[model samples]
Target: MSQHESRWSLAHTGNRILLAVIAGALIACLCGGTDLPVATQLVILLGVGGVTYALVTLLHRTRR
Candidate 1:
């Protein structure tokens, strides 16, 4: 494998922004004392992450 391909990165600005949004959501849930069950929270987070990944890829390709 190439050295560049082997490294981990959130190299795009869109990716970094999505990461911050995920973190902010977690903090808000914690501070606001949300009553979401563990399973529900996990599903919601995974859904958000999946959608973010898809949107970033879609937007990045068009911009390129």
Candidate 2:
């Protein structure tokens, strides 16, 4: 594989793990009986995390 592709693959793996952890945290908070307001905040966090993950992945792919 080319140098750039290898770098991107590493980055993508790390980002995927980070995103998964964020999602897991959201789920855990909801399951823990957090109140509506706090649960809503966790939902927002999930959304932002998803978007950021997507953007970074796209940018990495485009650089190849």
Candidate 3:
């Protein structure tokens, strides 16, 4: 495998995806992309992000 591929582990990829999700959500909120209130949006974002992180962590551990 290429050095780049070896260095880019599953855990790292998962983190990047999580970060992207958070950034996108923030952008959407700031841009008024949704009708929901800011507090509601934040709550939804946290719930989704928490579940996604848990799933990623579980998969990473199982692969070991």
lDDT by residue for model 2 (1-64), tens: 6455454353767856586567657665655675567667666667766776777677767876
Lowest lDDT sum, 10 consecutive residues, model 2, at: 1-10
Q: Enumerate clash totals for all models, in the order shown.
A: 0, 0, 0
TM agreement with the true structure for every prediction: 0.54, 0.52, 0.57
Summing lDDT over every window of 10 consecutive residues in candidate 3, give the lowest-scoring window: 1-10
Residues 1-64 of candidate 1: C-alpha lDDT, one tens digit per residue: 6446222345566655677568646754664567877777766666666666666667656764
Q: Supply candidate 2's per-residue lDDT for 32.
A: 60
lDDT of every predicted structure (CA atoms): 0.62, 0.65, 0.66
Query: Could you tell which candidate, 1 or 2, scores higher by lDDT?
Result: 2
lDDT of 3 by residue, 26-60 (tens): 65566467687877777776666666666777887
